[model samples]
Target: MSARFEELDWQPTDLGEISLRRRRDPSSGADVYEVKLDDDFLMSSLFTEGEVALARLGLAAASGDPLDVVVGGLGLGWTAEAAFQDPRVRSLLVVEALEPVIGWHERGLVPASARLVPDTRCRLVHGDFFALAEDPRGFDPDSAHRRFHAVLLDIDHSPRHVLRPGNAALYEPAGLRRLARHLHPGGVFALWSDDPPDERFLSALGEVFQDAEAHTVRFDNPVLGGTSANTVYTARTPQP
Candidate 1:
């Protein structure tokens, strides 16, 4: 099912005065989500179109039949679950910065994340994504992460998302350039953003990689008559 429902069950809070809401679901359980601006929940147990598209683009870029995927951020497992559905996915590594988010999923609070966590091919890297990105030499060649044919990142709202100041580097020209070096030829780097991105991010992407494309996608919302909008930044690695 599409991730359309927002938890009206939540109460208001201040993430140091940023004004946030925590989504509640007994089935998924409490502390499952955090919403910025109170009007929208940032992450949930349900999946969204942006996350699904991240998976689809990743799968399409793989030159090989079965693909190894490295997913940055494991919010509610929507992106991971969507990408894992492809038979071409040989392994999926979900990197999450928040331990509590992982705990919530492990406790069976979120259905999508909970389902994929138990898969044999699934591995959880319990740390910040940058740490993984910086230490490419530290990676084992045969490991699931090192062998990835695709890297899908859904860590923030978009290049514009800055829940943490450090996250901004993920979209910088230098950071994107680093990602290009990590992927196999013809591999794809799919990014999910909460809203349409600024030209700066797009231009930076163009500077770093080849065949860059941005897709504006929307997900149907029963709560909202129209739809929620977001952008997908997809770039290709050169094939040898």
Candidate 2:
């Protein structure tokens, strides 16, 4: 079957080199978006539900303390925008590798993402999220510290759609260890992925962290443009 086909009732979006197609299921009509990079359907936006839930986890977990956050993968800016809503978040550091994806936001491809997550306390950096997530150079404990209350990541298609070829390393034990190392005590590290399978992911988390858990949540496809369920990886960091 072809990657993208016309649907009678759906919303279509054109953002430079990417195209977003959305449709809802008939029964519940859950929302999902299909992201077409160039001509290929890359990932689905229905996964945003998990992303949102993960963001909420960060918001609640980091509420009491002033939060310094790191968000990987700025897809449609949904998670970043959500995190920005929380007053507890004092600073937000967003890292995305793809320039075209970033351009889509700057060009106002998506409404919420059209540079509208205005908190003035944000730093948008273009680089590999894994590298930034563990940069000792960026973290200065003496002066203005670089501590994170939460690290939310949405790279690759939730481990199932590993299209980028480079994202696999981020899920390995080394990557998780680095993520845990930089996280603040009681800080949250969440990952959103496609489907609930692959025990390897769970094991990878266990190998690096103290407590690891996975949550199954149904989300909208944004690509198929309908409702579907996926998994969210949630882990906690040790406290000093």
Candidate 3:
């Protein structure tokens, strides 16, 4: 048994004060790891079904063997871990804005780190995901204009509700078009949102991709008692 509550790590970045904490859940008798930005709760290990589903659904939509993937958040490493579960994932490039979060994984502070850090297919890069998405060079630092089979994003709360105002651009039609350039034809782009499906965002995706859909992932909310849901939006690039 560990302490009731312990802050694993904390750091100040341009985004805000970010912290990682671990606490014992009395009801489940399990350790729960959480990440927070200032007072805002960013992610919790207890509710990761949506994150896992983001990668699963995105990869499922991609049509190809030996897929290359780019995950645009490193919170708790659930999305990246889930991506690796698919044997088709030949490489995974996880872009994180905060360096401390990457350190947490390299230092093995998070449970998923044990599985992710040792995997040769996984490469954790410390960079702004939104900036990388808009850049022509794309997510890979060494390879310019590199294309991937899937891009799974779980950084913002929703297309309308973003952590940073600048991030909102990525949800727009122009930005969507720019991101599509980094995806191979028939590639998939999936996003995890705390809010319910937004038709406006779906319409924007439709303008940029050949196909788009929203999936509602429901999971038992242990703390709140009832079930809670998150949305995963998947869009596929046009095939040749």
Candidate 4:
């Protein structure tokens, strides 16, 4: 029997009306959880290869034993959950702009949320990622001096495309520098892009970091009956 479609949560935020729903994928006959912001589909459990890869590839860049990480988006908690899979991760702070999205995870409305809440390594922080990145104090308000091993971001679709006007600066030269301040030397900065590898963005990243590259994560899209791909832009801070 196929799972029936239903809306699980809904709320209004500074951005727009956001919602979460669960439904059966007609083509694959599998239950899928999805989050939508306004009219745009933000994320879907059915296709989360890129989200998972954002964490995996980002963590790979870190050379330290105990890793401190920050994930900039909490759509469905898949990325944060994947971060925990690496036993080397000592602490993970997920910074989310939307309150409802964080609430969904705390309420156990999302599958990955169940795993994230019980894990002592993880904590969700409700705040503007851009603001925090630009601030000299950084993401962790409690510990202003704390630096992360990696900063995995998946909030915006890509550098060329953003949900808000303020976010455009985040991919620019000045904004990239502000973000780099939060990372330790040789730390990783990875971002998930819906579009394929963007050379222009990588060039921008290279200007700020020591080494920058894009990893293309391909996965089957049951709805499209073909393979689709997303880009994970990984960059490493300079070593002192």
Best by lDDT: 3
RMSD of 3: 0.6
Name the candidate that leads on TM-score. 3
How do the residues 1-240 of candidate 3 rate in per-residue lDDT, one tens digit apiece?
989999999999898999999999998889999999999999999999999999999999999999999999998999999998898999999999889999999999999999999999999999999999899999999899999999999999999999899999999999999999999999999999999999999999999997799999999998899999999999999998
Instruction: Please give the TM-score that candidate 1 achieves against the real structure.
Output: 0.79
Per-residue lDDT of 235 in model 1: 82
lDDT of 4 by residue, 39-65 (tens): 989899988899999999999888798
Q: What's the residue-level lDDT of 87 in candidate 4?
A: 92
The global C-alpha lDDT for each of the candidates, from Candidate 1 onward, is: 0.70, 0.67, 0.95, 0.91
Ranking by TM-score: 3, 4, 1, 2
Model 2 Cα displacement at 44 (Å)? 5.4
Local distance difference test, candidate 1: 0.70
Error of 2 at 236 (Å): 0.9
Error of 4 at 152 (Å): 0.3
> How far off is residue 45 in model 4, in Å?
0.6
Would you estimate the TM-scores of all the predictions?
0.79, 0.74, 0.99, 0.97
Ranking by lDDT: 3, 4, 1, 2
